[model samples]
Target: MTYRDFPMPAGLRRTVPGGSETGGPEAGGTVAEPAPAKASATVMLLRPGTGTDGLELFVLKRAATMAFAANMLAFPGGGVDPRDADPDVPWAGPDPQEWARRMDTSVEQARELVIAAAREVFEECGVLLAGPDAGSIVADLTDPVWDEERDALLSREQSFAELLIRRNLVLRTDLLSLRAHWITPELQPKRFNTRFFVARLPEGQIADDRSSEATEVLWAAPEQLLAANDAGEHRMLPPTRVMIEQLARAASLDDALRPAERVWPVLPAPVEHDDALWMRAPIDEDGNGLPPTVAARNGDRPQGELPVMTPWTGGPLNERVTCTLCPNPSPMTLEGTNTWILSAPGADEAVVIDPGPLDEEHLQQVLTDVAARGARVGLVLFTHEHWDHAQSLERFGELTGAPLRGNFPGAEPVTDGELFEIGGLRLRTVLTPGHTMASVCFLLEEDGILFTGDTILGRGTTVVAHPDGQLSAYLDTLEKIADLTTGSVTTLAPGHGPVLPDAAATVRQYADHRQERLAQVREATVGQQDRPRSELADLVVAEVYAEVPRNVWPAARQSVLAQLDYLDAGS
Candidate 1:
């Protein structure tokens, strides 16, 4: 709505939605220096669409009565206001300096662009892209109080900074992923330098049709929009159309949010196509100047060796598997718990594994993601009852109205060989009791992949957990997992960290690490078996786990205790 001709600063030419970018009388007409493009931001707001993993992107059709890019479809965005550069604006996520490097702009300009992106979306659609803090996103703004603030922002009576500070909120830049940069071809009297961004529809927030510039606002999946455009149903620019093309390739909404590795700027130029005038840019199919190397989903030595995994924020692992990273990251919880959803291709029913911790936002994220997939939670299964994995169990049951089953206290009983068939997926339970007496793994009969809860991790070694976990039983479970990997399993979706691409090798590495740690414990006890258990445990941890983080030494101590119990070491 703010784009009412989206008044921009002088410079950057405009490539009309379906018009020519070739400018200044290319056929020898009089020419003049192009005006400087106005600084602007465009948000490609996305959400899970119904009945599939494909994502729905939000778009607005500017009313023909409006000034800028009128009657053309665009995302929520507008020219940057000077007030947006205010240093006092509440900020969170990556700092301006980092954003500067990422967006190829000055720190001050980067700050303004980010704030403008967040602000324009709110002013136009009444959907705030910010929250009370960096780690949290506002869920709902349906209250009348929010409407008042939205009005204030739109009218410029209150600066975006003042509104945020007054509400004690911060612009959650971390929620934004910079996709590409584009400059209008240098022939237009009014031009724009726009930064394109993609962000998920934050939980609890909905896109309302309230913008002043547009007569239409809707959310449709990438393919749906493309098909509509092809049919002359939705008119759009090359940038918007190309972006939709990219979204069509995304396996899930999470995949769509992954930032391009290198964002080279794009300026649409006119090209002759089949004797017809066309606007073209150097953007690739993935919406970049070239193919992008997305952030690695695996940490150092992803599968073969035991090392902490990279921060895998979660995405579609395959056609049927999706991981939603919880917000609870720590030394113990790698990168927070990974709540997994399993469904068959195009099935209406799905199976959820590990609801994860009780963070309200996380629970809603999982639920919202499931809805996006357009699948009903047919069954909820827990790998174990650790709070990190099952704390939200009952709350999830309340959210989905689905049956809950697992080895946990309140869960209905499941057996080692119990098989479940849902939405065309065949999952078999493999009782894995080393991490806990009830820790289990689910083998996806179709994919030959195993959901190895905490019994095995994608990165680092899992704790036997002492009293609750036994080294002997755990060792046997590893062997079982290894045997499956040797046969049908190829990938491992761990409870924490990235998915292991090499399941056989990863399982073998886990088994070998356990044995190696046991050997170290045995050697550390030489002439020290007579020492007190605490002292001996500390000694073993210091000698064997010196390379591991001290913060996780307590968990290592548990493993040491399990090893001690198995070896009958110390009193």
Candidate 2:
């Protein structure tokens, strides 16, 4: 599938008038400011998969009558109850103080979140996460007496701790493991700071759709659920969708619950443009984010400092740069296209790089920001002719009445080492054609920043976009950019994601990754020299790129084909 065809999880933004990119109330809108997120907890109950299934998670479809996330598939969870904060409740297993350290919350709040998770699991799914003692779990909870207690708990006639005490059971805090923490976006009417936990379904108990809040319940493999969601047959919130994607990486319940030294909270920032909304999650150069699964697998530990993330809220990045993030975010574009404004200090004329797509609101926002900075657009430039990076070229030039330059057919052709001056700013075009034939990188001679376009992304590797994108040329471009990094290029102003601090290291890493992929492709295609090109590409993908998701293999196939072509030409 193409980048546009890739499915993205639905966001939670409610339609509002005069909303800005960050979903804050606009100047003339009557919409009230969003309220703070209420503390909540959720649990993903897992069990061994049957037949060809992998690990399956217990999920429920919320009733359509609910106030929030109505008619959506979700794990059992709810907001923390006031009674959940009661320290007098009977408990067992891990101490609340230890749980506090794990969850990055206060001891009282950690106790409440864990209690709420257990309470909601029983209240919604008829599976209690408690046992008679600290070392054991309740094997069976199907008795009618248990049903009465669950009903009473759900109705608030009795607290979860009270139910546990009456049944002579201890809340099994050790059974649950932290999966993730997601805060609802500010654009949504209702917000939640939900901590997600994963736990094994007790041996002798079954999860039943017993709660009035849910319309149905089922056990589904994580991959199957993701496929259904991708096919539009199932609907889920962004957090739920991302969690399921993470769960798909695990082969068993033990793998899914592997303990991590630290888990970073995923706070998806909201960006709105031209009536379209997206939740932008921060990711690294490999397009990998702090998904709990990734963290757990690598045993990542929180240190003194974490990687810096560029805010989705459009604003000045520095004295010479300003970034206005577009609202279109997908698997390929982490936070959306970063429309950059470059100007020298105290200069009244600025240069706009990569106008980005044809979104009128984004184009207008760029102009508004430029005017706000007491500057007029002096020149418009393109890094390549790819629609995402250059579609708005003429429109922006029309609006700013600035001269346009790029490697495109009609625009002023920029050659390697070609220099342009915008006020006191000096930019030299460096031809870097790997992503697209026309791709180029701009060097800010004085600022030590490189406008890398798609040749280098802030949060992931760029696709060679085979046929139009040559692997040999792309490799050369990576080396060329890496050589420049040895000098003054300290920061990378990429077309997507954030501004990277280590430009040279990133370039070298990109080159190394490309070489590794090339070697893998060469090895995978060995002794298949007589095979059809299409067949060879498929074999390469199956053997070399087997771990990549099938949805992305189409693009991967493109790169694989490019690699094969490179190898063939070399031979």
lDDT of 2 by residue, 453-500 (tens): 888775446777788889889888988887888897888888876677
lDDT of 2 at 202: 90
Which regions in candidate 2 have their CA more than 4 angstroms from the true location?
Answer: 1-314
Evaluated against the true structure, the overall lDDT of model 2 is: 0.74
Worst 10 residues of 1 by lDDT: 20-29
TM-score of each: 0.46, 0.49
**CA lDDT of each candidate?**
0.74, 0.74
Best by TM-score: 2
Q: Model 1: runs farther than 4 Å from truth?
A: 1-310, 547-549, 569-571
Tens digits of per-residue lDDT for model 1 on 281-339? 44543556522222111121111122111237888988899998898876456567889
RMSD, each candidate, Å? 26.1, 20.5
